[model samples]
Target: MNENQSSRRRFVVSVGTAALVGLAGCGAQQGESAQTSTQQTTTQTETTTPTEAADTPTTTQKSSKSDADGPVVEMKTDNEGSYFDPKGLVVEPGTTVRFVNISGTHSTAAYHPDNDDGPLRIPDGADPWKSKLFTDTDAVFEHTFETEGVYDFYCAPHEMLGMVGRIVVGEPQGGPATESPTDIPPAAQESLPAVETIVSEQRVSGP
Candidate 1:
């Protein structure tokens, strides 16, 4: 072979060997790091993130305020939406829930049989008491809940307009009194929001 042919052949062999060495180096690098990268990815996926706005149960009991100074559910007029303002509350047992007439006549009566309108409902062994026509403003009627249960009440006149409210008295000694709202009167049942809404969202203090 001539000198040029020999030089060209040597250059070609050198290039092929360098390429083989480069491919081997790349394989070794991938083999070393592939497992580590996979481990890192799995760790990132397994980490748990915190939630937003965790729901907390809160209960507001009746302070030392007298019947006149207590929380007043407004007796709304035709112009105003005829629903109980605040809709529900959590009060201590023996705390008297006072219903004050604001405009229209309203009644805060329980879903109990003593009212001649129930079949052992709302609360057990609890006398259902409703006020006479509360036509004047600040005209009040009150009931002290000694039992630990959910009490749903409604206005006799405007119950169809969804004029209703709920009260959770002390820490309930019982689980959900009723499985569902099937037994409750359809007008009264549909009037108020579910009592679960009050029980789950609120807790009674001092007990």
Candidate 2:
């Protein structure tokens, strides 16, 4: 073959090889870019799914200051009769107690002279409280105890039925509530918790 022809053939073969290599490099770069994009999308989905689920909220009832500080006493009625649950309770000074009526008609009245001219049972000079009759279910009455002594109260209408309760603010005190009363009925007097029991147990259930 002539020298010029051989040189031209070699040059054409070299040019074709270079073009093939360039095309292969461009195809590899495109594939790598596509893989990286897919990985990024998968990572974002995995990270965000759990975060959204963790932000969900739950429902609950609101609590009042009175409920948070003192215990709840329930007035309930059964086949036997109507009575106050936890007939006796002990609390710190300034604690507000919540009285809830579960069933039957009821009222909480302090054994003070101001209330129906009853005997003085609570601490002297302490504020008196008397609740109206509760005929419906889920009725609520609240009272704050500021005096540090024994408080004797009863269900006015049902007092004859022996529905009575006692509350000790901080300690026991010498009062009409502490002594055995001859004025009230036997059942009503008996329903009143003993001062010793209320101080020791902190809570006493109805008879």
Best by TM-score: 2
Across 132-162, the per-residue lDDT of candidate 1 in tens digits comes to 5556566555555656777776677766666
Q: Specify the poorest-scoring 10-residue window by lDDT in model 2.
A: 41-50
Please state the error at residue 8 of candidate 2 in Å. 99
lDDT of 2 by residue, 1-207 (tens): 112211011111122222222234435354432222222111000000111232221211223424564588888778868788889999988676777778888888878776687887887656556777777566566666766788888898889989989998887767666777666767888888888999999999985
TM-score, prediction 1: 0.57
RMSD of each: 31.2, 32.8
What's model 1's overall lDDT? 0.51
Q: Kindly provide the TM-score of model 2 when superposed on the true structure, using C-alpha atoms.
A: 0.66
Clashing pairs counted in every model: 0, 0
Please give the CA lDDT of all the candidate structures. Answer: 0.51, 0.67
Instruction: Give all TM-scores, in the order shown.
Output: 0.57, 0.66
